[model samples]
Target: MHPCLEQADILELIFKEIYYRPTGSHTEKDLLALALTCQRFKEPALDTLWDTQLTFGPLIKTLGISDAEKESENDAFDRDVRVILTNDSYEPSPEALRRFSSYARRIRRISHVPDARSSILEEMNTELAVLVKLSSWVRSETPGPMFPNLQHLGFIGTLSWTSIPCLIILLESKITTFSMYWGNLDPKESEVLIGLLGRLGLSIEFLELTPLSYIRTPIDPNKPSIFSEMPFPITLSWIIPLLKELRSLSCGSISLNQLALQNLASRCTFYKLQSANTSDDLLEAISDPTADILSPFATLQHLELFEDNFRDFIKLVDYMQPLALQTLILHHTAPPTASTLADLLHSFSEGQHIASLRQFSIKHTVSEFETINSVNMDIVFDGLTLSPLLSFPNLLIVEIDTPCGFDLRDADIRAMAKAWPQLRRLQLGSKIGWGLPPSVTLVGISELLIHCPRLEDFVVPFGARTDPPPITNSTPIKKNMTYLYVGNGRAPGDGSEQMALARFLKHVFPDLCGVGGEWMYEYGLEEEQLDWAAVISLIKTQC
Candidate 1:
């Protein structure tokens, strides 16, 4: 035997290098050949090959066929290629189980998402039944879990009473990360799913559950939907005790009510929480006269709430202070009232989150239910509306994407740039409004680059009407900036305006690569888009 083969670590490293290569590299065939070479190479080679299993088909085939099943001519190759399960009740003998255990123990990750493009799991229809029988046999013979070293498990399919047990069996204390996506289910099935996850306890750390919806009946415009995105209410309230060590959680459309928020804050040490729909439960709870003032989300660092109108957010800041909160993202479903917007912005200072907060994003767009004109007339974010955030020293990224007009002037842009010298990305609005002219101009952008040298990706709406200031010897050349989004800013189609603006950008933003804007054809502004494209071309050639 080679001396390198005697050292298990060195041999494993060589096998891993081959295994981690890109697909269609023939790493599997080569590893199988090395496993059949000698006893020394077999264990390490097989270990590398079985580290990650995309499907349970390979494990099911390890049980072998029954006596009633007839073997085909290409049965050996067929078995190697796909799972051939003739009998779900085929009991694997002690010797067969020993073979299965060798490979099963080597598995570290199993992600069996059904109907995944170009995956073996697409063929897994009735084959999961064999796993139930196999798990039972393994438990009876072996003292520990089947996949002892398995740390990550993901399943994206239907979860019934029978399949829930399969998942429960898979959930050992060693697993840390889990992801599951399932279609609509009844309340009972949801209970079973929650119960299954409850077993993980403190062992699990990262959890993401996306509840997919499927409609069986036709839509009726007259009546309201019983199934509003999420079919059944799946709360994380009961599972709070189990997920004490959870660091990140994403509950798609599954709301975390006020009590759940309190429990999570008091019990769990999670830092990140995201929900598609943040209901008014928190607001209602805090407003209750009988409710006691308790500290909520003490350890939370990142929070993203979708489909909210800042009413709950306003109440949250009023009730509790986010001592450790860093990132706050609010995607409003409805246009925020001027008072609500002012209150929400000013609450950051009251909460003492000015120093800790780094990234702040507030986004809202006009839907079919509302028009651009309504959004424009309702609220216009100006210097005063955004002035409260000027105290955040460590703020790196600020994105306020409203599809309406912004009333921010040149002074406001310069004030922001001067406030956060460490600013990297400053995105203002979507630039989709009409008839409302922009207040900030090209000179404001020049001043922004001068103050914030670290600013890279900048998106803002500014009037391209006035000519930019002439470049001088003392002008600060911002070489770090690469992309600038012109939003809904219209540019002059005249050659003189385009050349001068292009020249100014080239002198100030030396590293500027591309200039982008919103789709102009939707608003019949093809000439405006063409003018910006001309600026990009001039920046490259004029320099």
Candidate 2:
């Protein structure tokens, strides 16, 4: 044996490196070979290999309850699949059960994906049932939980009757993180899930539930699914008090209303919510006039809402004065009007979030069948649309992606740079329309570098047709900026213009990494893209 392998810590690290290779045969093959090589290498090697289990095939193979073989050659679709067939009468010996227990206790995470495409799906469910049945026998003779060290359990695929029992048996009070993305469930199945949550008690800290998917008229048109009516929200409300230790939650919008009723929302640290409900329902859920508390999310540190309207977003910001919030993100389909945007900012100025807020982003996506260019030109974002955000002087990151043109001038850019002197990232106007050329020029960007020397990722629209302002001795060289994007920027695309622009960027941003637009050639920037690409090559040679 090698000297390095004699040390337990060094041997574990070596096995871990082999076990975690992203894409290679050495991941499992090398670990398995080492586990069977000798006694010294066996324990560490097996522990490293069985640390995380994604499927039930390995446990079934170890228990000798099933045999896996390739499908028949006649079946073209499943020709490469190895199908498992269980032996109902088979039972492992005492020595084999002890070995299985040893391997099972080593697992820390079990992420079950029950949507395998081949016959293995049912076979794996059968194998899981067999394992659950054997778990009692093992526990009766040898005491303690089947998976004593399991902490994280995830259901990435659909859940059915056969798989639900497997999850129930694995739901230990010691588990801390649970995430599931199951499809629609019947009333009985939903109750079983609720019972499982009750069993989980206060140990879980991170819980994420993806919205269930359903067909319009799968069985009956008039009859609604059990999950669509009110079982989900009711179940969540019943389980809220049991989750006193939960710190993070991500679920549908209806659950927010339910959470508002419970006392748990006040203690949550992070929330990422989305909704397919109407704007009225969203608004009502976020801000209930009848509620007693003024701020439901006072202790939240991060909040991210998606697929809601601008009105609902405004209401949420106003209602949850988030005293300690550090991050706020909103993504909606409807465009925000100038007055609505002003009201939203006014809420921020009056709220207690001004002191602790560091990152604020709002992204809008155009409705289907309508692109940014096709939208009406009456809706545009100007300097006033963003000036109100200057109230939060501690901001470090700000990103706004609107589906309209920006009428900002040189003065607006300078004002923004001066307001957030500690800003590290500033991205605006991602979907630049084709109405008018940007009035800001290269000189305005120089003002940003002058104020915020630590700015790293800068994306904005500016005119590149003219020469930059003269550099003075007081000018500073900003080496932190890596990527500078000029989306939908107006450029002359001439040799003089390219040379002058390259010299100006090199002097101000000496360590500039890349020069290009955010949406390269997506809209009609083919000519402008070529000009910027040339400037990138010139900057590289000069550096």
Candidate 3:
């Protein structure tokens, strides 16, 4: 046991690379091996080894099985290795206790993913009981708060909604970052959830609460219903004031009622606020002139409006004057006209809010099937010079869509390029509705390449000219141009013209990488379509 290896800092630095390596396969294997090298390495290496665990199986293995004991194989969390741990439980031996104490005490994060099998309830219960018991045993004096070193904890969605109360109490005030993705929380869990929010509200710096899954996922009827007892709305008032330390918060389908929105607006402080659907109230409440303004969320740096109810957009935009707002995302609903998009960009043009914005996206909601073929955006690109938007001199990403149709031509694109020459990621145009694609040809695209040298990722409507350009060595290498996902499908699928256009693009932007939509390859006079590979092939060959 050398003094050099005794340093936890050095060992942790050495072990972290293996522990957090990208590939999932036992990243901790080397750390475990290091733990065996010497007693000094044993403590630090074991600490790094058990810090994050996929299953408690590794910890359960530390408690040796007795002759009479047999672990249940009912639920196979990891089918590769089956030991459900419910069969015949045994008390921890002195040697096992010493070993468990050595490692378990060093745990900082626990990712408890219960089996998704039919017996998930039983499996989660069994696992929770073990954690409750083990933590109690490890910290003898305390009945709960098992791992004093634990600061981050996560629970899988497979558990029954009934077990949330117990889970919350088990966490107590020790953990500062918590994530629970339980899909649906019944009325009973809501009561526990409210209390849990209160108890840990002050301590939590980062929180993720997922009580509901995506809008498309069908509800499990056999499971307890979320609406059974008129589910309690989770108001921000319950959290915001208390959680002065809160920096990041994410809630899925949890209602942020008016009272909560008021508190947030009035207090007007936080780093990030992201939630789905609840912004209906937050937007309305924050927009209210009489809502006790510190300019209602002026301190908000990042705001993601995935609101299901996007009724008053004009009003929403009126109140979106965040002093430090950097990234803004609006999901679902009618696409904003170029004029409306200009205003949002204009918000950054003036005030102390100047020049800090980097990414702004407005994606039509995915859940709305009715809008699949409906007209959402019909814009006259000539009217939307959006020159004021160019005031954002350091802009990095801009996606203002016209899902219905946009009358964008070559001159309009050249004007756009003149406005924003620093954009790295640009996603314009739309694919959902029935309309003629915006009239942007290779000439306009050529201007974009010539102007924005740093352009890397792009998704825009593209069309080839009736008379294509003659290739020459004058084309500057748009080497930074990489990914392309065309919103509008192929413009001219005609064999020679389209092929020539592809060849021209690959020539000009010698490193031009990909084209989106249905891909087809030229076969003599005709072309055979192979949507995926064919389009990618167009972007590779150097001019």
Q: Count of backbone clashes for each model?
A: 0, 0, 2
- Cα lDDT tens digits for candidate 3, 1-543: 122223556657766766777777554566677666756556556667677865565555455442112333332223212233343344455676666655566778877776444353443455565555555455553334556577887876544655554475446647778787745555455545654666564677777776332343322213333434434433334556676667677665555556556665565346666666444567667766777565677677776666434445434545665466678767655455555556645544664444677777666655523335444445544325455556566677877544546566778667767767787877665543224654776677777767777788666666553545677665646756665554444445554555676676666656656554422211232232243235346555322
**TM-score of each predicted structure versus truth:** 0.67, 0.66, 0.69
Instruction: Please report the TM-score between candidate 2 and the true structure.
Output: 0.66
Output the number of the lDDT-best candidate: 1
Ranking by lDDT: 1, 2, 3
- TM-score, candidate number 1: 0.67
lDDT of model number 3: 0.57
> How does each model score on lDDT?
0.67, 0.64, 0.57
Better model by TM-score: candidate 1 vs candidate 3? 3
lDDT of 2 by residue, 166-265 (tens): 6766775388888776345554565567557766546888777654121111122123335443443335555666777777765533233344343544
**Poorly placed runs, candidate 2 (over 4 Å):** 1-144, 154-166, 180-202, 210-244, 252-295, 306-324, 365-376, 421-424, 431-435, 446-456, 468-485, 499-525, 534-543
Question: Considering TM-score, where higher is better, how would the candidates rank from best to worst?
Answer: 3, 1, 2
